[model samples]
Target: MKLIKTEDAVGHVLCHDMTQIIKGVTKDAIFRKGHVVTEADIPVLLSIGKDHLYVWEKEEGMIHENDGAEILCSICKGDHIERGNVKEGKIDLFAECDGLFKVNIELLNKINYLGEMMIATRNGNFPVKRGDKLAGTRIIPLIIEEEKMENAKAIVGDEKILEVKPFIHKKVGIVTTGNEVFYGRIEDQFTPVILNKLKEYSTELVEHVILNDDHEKITEAIVNLINKGADFVICTGGMSVDPDDKTPLAIKNTGAEIITYGAPVLPGAMFLLSYFNGDIPVVGLPGCVMYSKRTIFDLMLPRLMAGERITYEEISKLGHGGLCLSCDICTFPNCGFGKGM
Candidate 1:
């Protein structure tokens, strides 16, 4: 990495295309930040009595946090933001009326960047008062390879440097295994329950299969699903110690590595998780999950849809909040007992 002073440049900034080669070194072979650059290494520039060398370091981005308290002020619909109303990102506003209001992140950014701004309300344009939370911004850290710093600088232009993490979408497959359901001895109510829970996320139920609790049959079914492109596969029923319970054996027979065969959660403590090629995930759920208000299935389904691979340690942590009170109100959406988002 090289840093030429502004005075040393004949005209504009002495920027180089750091995208390709840095000091005749390729990206794969370049030294990272915190690497020591000795003076003896600079044979050309050191010959001119230049003792100092430029080094690359990681840069961090700015983030602002907002308090939850906010107040609406009374003002006309066209009024602008009151000057000096916001100090240190806190604001005090007048109440136009009593109602639920939401301050989104976009409006907050505009207010912060452009200063005083106009807001739209139900009655009319009103001057925004203090103690109003405009928006919320999450802090993000950025890391740039030393060789790519120059390339970044040249293309930065008027854009702000922000680091965003890529979102990973998890694909899940469901396999319902039970002789009673397959032969119509009982209704196939389990699959519907699982599907209804999975519907809360962006997950696609890529494959669905029903197999008798035969080890070989279940094993073959699981292998076919994985081969058919299933990142996460769920097998319902046959998780207990009953002789007819062959789901665990079937999952093991597929040769997929098992992470945990039993979880510490209630109503679904017998849950199991396995993986193959460190990519595909497989789970075995117990019968209690079918009718339980909150089970291991409910707890883990969101994480799976959110692209989180469950670990045994994380599953173990659920024991504290695993018990469901099964209240009469049945406010599952607002309850934290295993249903908290």
Candidate 2:
């Protein structure tokens, strides 16, 4: 691009977006990049204090900001993702469907390390609704070396830098364990909480079983739910170390591989995650989930619904940013709870 006086740029192409700010009203692009500067736009440019402007200049071995941003988009774009038209050298990405959003942090950092280029994304491994902004790609300069953009693509290779794993329909089963609830001595509150949570997903209440702290009976109930086409099973209560607490043992008896018997998160330290027959999830929930506004269950539920396997290493990392502030007005998922390092 070439820098020239705004008055003489009438026929030239704008190399970048011109931002027009209105105090407390609006601030947005008035003239987008690639716009052909006409006679009528000179006064508007001058009003914004633009005495000089950069005009597009075709050159070999160099790419404009919009083109560079497009390459960055190619590097990061993945399944179920959408990209907005480039503006001011930036391209914004969004989710095309409600699903699990993931970011390859390593790849993102590597690309950003390349000077004059950037990719900013929302923290990943969280559920996002359709049309949620996923990420943005931009170039710092009006133009960049073609070699630099090529290097960025090479870093990503074939793998996407961001992905939206679509959520699938699930048949959820609930097993409420505790002698008080099983014997009807106390109201069964856990099932109501579970049902409310399931309302956010495409799930059906396939089964609901109440059982005493007897590990054998709990195990039978869980296996029976899965055998009857339940893709996900959750056992509430009996997760702590009191001898009578037997939900963990019951989950073990079901032959599901336990991901973690305890997590580093608050309001859910005694959480248990497991998978039966290599794919079906069988979770053991602590009592906190029945009342807490947000817990580890909230963090892991979307991933499980998207069919992503949980690992012990991943659960251990929850120690960072795992404590919930428990505000009077809870804005979960949007808050820092369970957003680990």
- Scored by TM-score, the top model is 2
Mark the regions of model 2 whose C-alpha exceeds 4 Å error after superposition. Answer: 1-58
Instruction: Give per-residue CA lDDT, model 1, range 1-341, as digits (tens).
Output: 35654233222211221122445655442322222334333453344343443433323431121111121122111122222243222334333322122233243344234322223322111112233332222111122233332332243333322111122355667889889988889987888888887665446767899878788988888888777877888899889999989999999988888889887677787888888777677889888888886677766665554445667776666676667777877765346665211
TM-score of each: 0.52, 0.88
Q: Candidate 2 residues 51-158, lDDT tens each?
A: 999998867998777788889999899999999998667999999999999999999999999989999999898989999999988898877899999998888999
Error of 1 at 232 (Å): 1.9
lDDT of each: 0.54, 0.91
Best by lDDT: 2
Q: What's the distance in Å from true for residue 193, model 2?
A: 0.7
What 10-residue stretch in candidate 2 is worst by lDDT? Answer: 332-341
